[model samples]
Target: MKCNKFLKGISLSVVWITLSICSVSANENAAEVWRFGLEEIEGSVQDIYAQAFKRKIEDKSQGEIVVEIYSYGMLGESEDLTNLTANGTLQLTHASVGILGAQIPEAQVFTIPYLFSNNDDHNQAVLANNPAIYEILGNALIDQDLRLMTLYLEGDMVWSTNKLIRKPSDFAQFKMRVMNSSLVIKTFELLGATAIPMPYSQVYGSLQAHIVNGQTNPIFSIEEMKFYEVTEYLIWAGQQKFTTSVLANQAWYLALPAPHKLILNETIEELTPYIFEQQIALNNTQLAAIKKSKPSMALIRLTKKEQALFKTISTPIRQQFIQNSGQPGQRLLEALDKALATEK
Candidate 1:
């Protein structure tokens, strides 16, 4: 019975039960076991990516590599999971950018509102495998003993509040829930709101109890977590999205054989497009589900002029991100600008 928690989505084949077994290899090299942790539950984009990677690596290595997945709370929360991975207890984890930003401030560069464009392909190239992102930010993370892999673009962050948030002024009366990041706190403050920093797991209950008047998350997350049930309006701010990261333990990654590393990198390359497609589909489906379930909940898609109002105020947040990120932040910012510009 306890094993059910450990193997909730071993293959994610069965609805409630999973039956997966790595084959007994006849290869000379012993099989390597990797523990991968996710920030979302099974069937979410992160889990879908992890499962795909697991299947690919096991097949590519001829069973030389076996990836074991721990869905969300199965192991622990973001901070605990990331700590375990860094300490070599786990090989990999999908961590929230806000949590990662606390230790490696350069990561906070992503907290800057309206950093990425509306173009999906443009965002994907810069985020998924761009040297500008991984090479610049990745090099910095190595000093902290963690290897930055790739960024997962879940969807545009939409706000769920009992009232409409049509402009920055609307935020003044709301206590906005944000991740535990200084940049995020300041971002909300600059937008004229009282930011309540908390863990992701607490958002739903906080909204239900009126502890937090509003929260921002991708539509899929809001619908999946049932945040819509307690909130009255879904406002698409289009300022920031859920851009989490995949990371590996530096020591563990560096110690891996060249062949093993090759497999890991190649698998991630293939997982990128696949996961991106999944995120888009999942968000679209979930948004419809939320609308169907909460017929009275108003959906506010901010006009271009309205979005520009918030985007303009977000400029100071970028400067603050650079200050928080230090020297690398400048280079990282420049690199991102260059990448995005070139994409245009």
Candidate 2:
């Protein structure tokens, strides 16, 4: 009889332990889940960052907050995702700062040609050392129902084309695909190229069909889009560098539990430096890989004189951005100038 009683006791203990584990899992399931939308394909830098963000946030929060990333237009295109994120319909998104200008015009400053001397200046201004620039930019977005997180370093924008483009005059009459930003369109127009505004999804097809003669994108994106498959040249004019950002729905972000908010802010702080460094390294790797794989794709490094000609032609467009960005823009520009000067 005592043996049977001992067996029953063991079974009861097992049931209690199983119930306790179930209860803990149920509590974890109850934690809030935020959906992060990204347009980059799997293995791209943007997608890599999204995965890192999700991992760090969930790990730090101990599952009290969950981040689920939907990539490769799984959510929508960049413009659509930005709008959804702005209205709280979507929780988060990653995009170039220029794309947010429609919601906050001051963001256009980042898209201006030759904005940063190189990646290090851009990194300091956006992430490491410049609080003045961040404050001005963050203030501009606070009222727009979006929150600016940090400026991500991608790479300098390079022009890829089928024709050799070593000088400013060579750009004349070339049809180039540009983003929806007016500043980008004007930049290409100033170069004497016809700027065709097209969604990123269509870039490959457009290039294949020769719908546009070429497009401008980061060297990484040029590889991601496989533009070299159809095109034969890469122009290193150093005219513009791309700066992406992490933008959240202000309403959703502000209402997050204080602890959860702290986790996210902390995650950004930890990840920014790593991302800045990784992107610079990745740009070099991807550029080399593309060139080795596709020997037909040639590179044109513009002479200082060639870059000078571009700067001279694009001066009016840059001035217009400053004049039109308002006082906030002026302040941000001055702050960026200070940052760049100090870094140099």
Candidate 3:
């Protein structure tokens, strides 16, 4: 009996040791693989953020966490990536507010044209200091099972067309490809273009086949998408600005070890400005490159008066957006206005 008791005690000790080892191994494995997705082409803003994220996470985690980036719709389209992240199929993703807004209506506030008079105002409204703004926007995302990691600027929207767009009248009858955002569609409609909502991947084919005569994007996207090849005109309208939100699957993020979660949040905080600066630098370079490569492409430079005229025409569209988006839209506009007022 004494011998059997001793043997049982030894067996229990061994089992406990094995279980502890298994727990440690599981945690180590969890820290090793961090997967992320982006819809942008490689080297674009999305790509830049993904690369920055990988570098920072790996450096901070000391190789304990490795980040894998999938770009150019590798895992799926923009909408698919958004849904996957929401459902925890993907760990992380970067999506334009326009796409994310479709899932969380409150996000539409970022899509409001001219709501931000310039880049400085937009940045001020969304940063960490603005708790009211962040709280509202962040909660909207949280409700959708996504955590808003960071808001990164994608620059102002500009026009690209096979025909010149020097004036509002120039866009008349032009079939312009726009994201499937109601505000975007309304904005283009106000500008006199036949706004055709399509995915970014479809823009190229539509332009190539003359199914769409024009599209709008920041200059970096024009270069990245090779819009110059399909279009003969580039316009610097700066009609609207856009920002992308880096999001993580809330469940997946919460599942991470405390240290790993801290590392991810810290890495994103460090990477936001870095990625935005890179985007600005790239946009400048792309603008120069596009000018050099397609010298014949007409460049439409709008005068202040003409831009004002365009804004005047877009007022009703803005009103419609606010009305359609309801109280959430009002709250966003109020927050933006408050941010802008502080600048003065």
Clashes of each: 0, 0, 0
Where does candidate 2 stray beyond 4 Å? 1-29, 119-122, 125-129
Overall local distance difference test of candidate 2: 0.77
Clashing pairs in 2: none
- Candidate 3 has which clashing residue pairs, if any? none
lDDT of 2 by residue, 1-344 (tens): 11121122223443453355346545655777777878688877788788889899888888777776777666546766675566554588886776767556788888878767654645544554477656878887766677888777688889899899877678788899988888888888898899999889999999999999999888888997898888999988988777788888888887988888888889888888778777777788889989889987888888878888888889887677777788888888777766676543
Writing each residue's lDDT as its tens digit, candidate 1 over 1-344 gives: 11122223222332112112223222325667887988888888788889999999999999888898988777656676776666565789998788788777888887788888778778887788677678778886777677888887888889889888888888876898988889989989999999999878888899989999998888888887899998999998888878889999888898999999999999988888998999999999998998889789899998989999998987898888877877788889888877777543
**Where does candidate 1 clash, by residue pair?**
none
* Candidate 3 overall lDDT versus native: 0.76
Ranking by TM-score: 1, 2, 3
Model 1 TM-score relative to the real fold: 0.89
Give, for candidate 1, the lowest lDDT window spanning 10 residues. Answer: 13-22
* Cα lDDT of model 3 by residue, 87-171, tens digit: 5546898888887766566777777666665545357335545665578887777777888877867776888888877778888
